[model samples]
Target: MSELPLNPRSPLLPDRHPEPDFFVADIFDATPKGDQASMEHPLFTLATKPDMESQEYRHGDIFVNIGPSPIGRATVHDRDILIYCISQMMARINEGRKVSRTMRFNPHDLMVVTNRDVSGRGYLNFKQALKRLQGTQIETNIQMGGKEQWNVFSLIADATIVRETRDGRMQEVEITLSNWLFDAIEAKGRDLLTLHRDYFRLRKPLERRLYEIARKHCGHQKSFRIGLQRLQEKAGSQSSIYEFRRLISKIVSDNASHQHIPEYDFAFDGDFLDIYRREEGGALPSPAKRGLIVSDSARERAKKHAKGWDIYALEAEWRDWVTSKAIEVQNADAHFVTFAKQRGPYKR
Candidate 1:
């Protein structure tokens, strides 16, 4: 409950030992569990950074600024820990088991779940990630419980190393996740999206961020397109537009050469960039194959209705919002404009 760090770091007791569990077993399977799991919305920095420094982003009314900790700044890499945490909680929820924001778990379980090493350095890095997750700060107006206030909070409220290895390395840990994050999880997980297991293996932070944007907006559709400028903004990248474009261009080339990107393909045409979902036999799936086809001209009109907006992302949101309504939207452009007004713009 307090910001103070726990201490008395010591070796594990003679009786305390790691017990292999389902999560651990899942790691060794040919296909990792990450392929089937989904990451929460608010984690894994979408921007790439090379050092321990603060980051700020403002999209619509939501504002987030992640600060550093004593150990180091929480990088997009550190998000692997939180991803495993959310995956565990979601699994339990799907099984109809009672879950809580505060949890006690063996560190080995997390390492296995996230496809991380179990070495001594791995343990140290895991502990450091805990510090970063707890130390990183965020402030936003995303309406937690329908209230509006300006307050700063960490991804995790507190953590304690409950058990350790023979050499004083942490073995088991307990953490209380911040209420801001927990509330998002509890409110029916529609906002979250699934990610491929190879997501952890991506070498570059930008690559991971691009995958998240694609997975978030593309879903299982044939493809989704966005302007390069908006992609840079959504990524929260501090790089110059020219440099960012160069980086994306390399990814496009790599995707064509080695097919290194996971579950999706990227290509550039004029000012627009498209991320197409890859099917089983290296073929791009078409919307027509899925029995949903829209004329190219209609999509162009939707984009014209909202300047500097992503039509694909908006379309997905509109579809979800109107799915439960008795009357479907007759005028797509009008509904989209209303959605655009509600979200406003991202002002840095």
Candidate 2:
């Protein structure tokens, strides 16, 4: 195989310029205030309960705040979450710590660029990341990142609605180094790709599809349909698609332990994300929830509700807290060790 080159098309510009091909994206979520987990982001859809431990986002897991006119700004929570991670990286990198290069810019954060800097981990409004860079010399944390790093914080947004062009009036968008990630984006983009923003924004449902597909092949299924079918089988004969989706939702939310919330102990990815690392990035998906627990409160709530979401509500609180404080983790603190595992000191 030929060794691939870096930034073949260069996603970042010298000093930032108007990109005619890109458009700004802003997300809005319709789920009622009481509908979702605060940290999960409004766009996250319902997942099959069975697949959550596997990180399989399910269909309808996310009720995005978008179109037909739309709801509140699409939940840019994921984007904001990533942005917080970026800033934390920036602070740590500036302070001489190395963070992980394998980072996921929260998909929910794709939204209208309101300000350069975005605060809180709720979401990443491209406009907000820019706002974050104003006082600092860097663009988003990604803009200041290196070859091995994802500069997801740096986006190349364009106008979504094209006025004088051929494709009717509509929004279009792009990221800074998409040309470089043509492959990863293509494979991952299929889950929830939006041409409108020139970025990869996977709604909760889309993520579910990707997870299903990933589960089927684990590494070999090339046909998307066949792979999808295999995912269905994993749900078992008793599980309907809907039931499966809700099950997965329950797993993703409760994966982490927050007993350390106020007293968050020094931990590492090995502690919580441990299950994920148990296998290679690909392998067969687990047949059942790895280590999920249904609490008495959750079991009681389940009797009254058709689906389990309050479980998500509890996780959302920590999810939000993680995002909100991610940026601050860069600061020299007593708690930076555990939280900074992904975005912390690098071996180099």
Candidate 3:
């Protein structure tokens, strides 16, 4: 068969020499706090297209319902702005400096933080990203105060391009973040997680999603394991089970070879997958423990109160759930009993 012409559309292929649509330097200045990243929201789509279809995702009591808007739908790539903004704000907070929702920054600075180029086309893409963030509406049960109330808001409240280059490249940009997002930053910095600088370099959406799960769960711990089935559910991926398994196995193998993925390493043993942080010296401090402990008496009470409930299984779920939330429970045993009642008769 004759060799097919190089695919102009594929960015990954070196032989594919697509004509440059824009001129921007690919190198980025990964400065201090520049490589810092944060995500206040849970895992969402990794789609690059502006999909208008409405979708709902739920994990436990947390729910995120994305609605269509006239401007555009938010793509997962649009999350770059949030990661940059939140990471900067967190840096300030860490330094005992106050922060606010409205931020003024150079457009190029954002590109550096997100590991993008500073080209004319890149500037245009950045504006489009801002539009999607401002236009996409989300209804979520993520609380603002101490109450559990539904919040309806966009990812960004407003954006202003303050200055532009003679060639129409955006220079200064001002952003007013949605209250829902700002509240997440102010309420507790710990609610946010630091992502690797290479996160922006991840080309596949599913790979990004898996990395988020690893960052959230594994963090500084020696290792953490999740069943393949549970991981798929958590990812909310649409791929078939066989395809997902193959995809993940390949990622693990690839990561082992290159060690390109930051922060954590991936591995799988049979049905269980493990994520462990790389043993780099000067590890950032882990989040404070919840101090939740399941006592033997609590186990006894769980067995007595909830007949046919597996105490050990319930205890594991309770511990895992609370640990993920990073919250302490005053009464671990009583809480376990209540949780058991809700889940009742645990499945193997």
Candidate 4:
């Protein structure tokens, strides 16, 4: 297998918090969940540097126009803030607790969970990310949480630095999410998909965007295929078809060698791209057994939930239970992990 090409400009960040107990806070336990709308569309820029260009995208009747601020359009990396907020809100909802559009959190906690640097520079970059997120204006007809409306709004309504350290770094920060985004989070399972924690570790901007596409579209299925051209559009890449193909080829080669991409594997063949769920133990069932493909990552997580029990056995039981109950598993991996956790340790 060919080795991953060196990325001099934006190398992948090391896992800063590898130990599970690094975060003792309950909020850190919330699974990362991304809004489906932005994932489905090219709402954020993939540029590593400031991008001042305004872009428009149209798919069928859906239209999205994004304009950058003086600093630049929000990049995919900046989207981390939104993901963190959404995850927190979702956890509150799951607990049957009321949630508000405005959220306040410690900057350090956000940086740690997102696998970002905790240095002074990291905090500064984080504040800049907030600015890009708040300044970038978007006008869209995309319906979020089942509400279809033509509205022009920024990704965030406003962001305030509630408190700052003596050195002037933000300490406590408050962000007011736009109604469009909050509504999507309010819709719960309809507009959000759980993301792999390692998502923050991906180095390249294109790599992150590709993973989102795979997570959103392939989702819980054994595999998904898309034409190369269609994928470029979905990724919101500004590269020419030939250039895009070259970039994708590099990513496929890198993934093939290191298996760095979480959950899904990528393959490029001629004019199409195939995304497969990373499998272990045995072959994935044909047609994914009612679209319930469990990834190896999920299985490992399940082990924590049902200690001393064979995960495969628990999986069989979970599948049987779902079938018996005629339950439609929307997020199969999450549902299965939850089932295992609820099953608890095996009893003699």
Worst 10 residues of 3 by lDDT: 29-38
Tens-place lDDT per residue, model 4, 169-251, is 88799999999999988887688899998899998889998899999999989999999888998898999887787778767
Order the numbered candidates by lDDT, best leading: 4, 3, 1, 2
* Candidate 3: tens digits of C-alpha lDDT, residues 1-348: 232222212212132112322332221322222111123233345556656677777767878777765755775567778878877777677678898999888777667657665677888889888888887888888765343778888888999989987888887889998887787678656356657767777667667767777776777787899998778776655567766776676566445434556777765643677888888884322211233544556667677666654344445446557666766666655677787677655345
Q: Candidate 2: deviation at residue 53, Å?
A: 32
State the local distance difference test value for candidate 4: 0.83
Each candidate structure's TM-score, on Cα atoms with residue i matched to residue i, is 0.67, 0.21, 0.66, 0.77
Tell me which of candidates 1 and 4 scores higher on lDDT.
4
Among residues 3 or more apart in sequence or in different chains, the pairs in candidate 1 whose N, CA or C atoms overlap within 3 Å are: none
Model 3 stretches astray by more than 4 angstroms: 1-43, 69-72, 144-147, 281-348
Question: Which has the higher TM-score value, candidate number 1 or candidate number 3?
Answer: 1
Q: Residues 117-205, candidate 1, lDDT per residue (tens digit)?
A: 77888888788778888887776555553446666788789999998878987868898877876665575454445567677667777
- Tell me the deviation in Å of residue 258 in model 2: 23
**Model 3, C-alpha of 2: deviation from truth (Å):** 27
Error of 3 at 63 (Å): 1.7
Q: State candidate 2's TM-score.
A: 0.21
Measured by TM-score, how close is model 3 to the native structure? 0.66
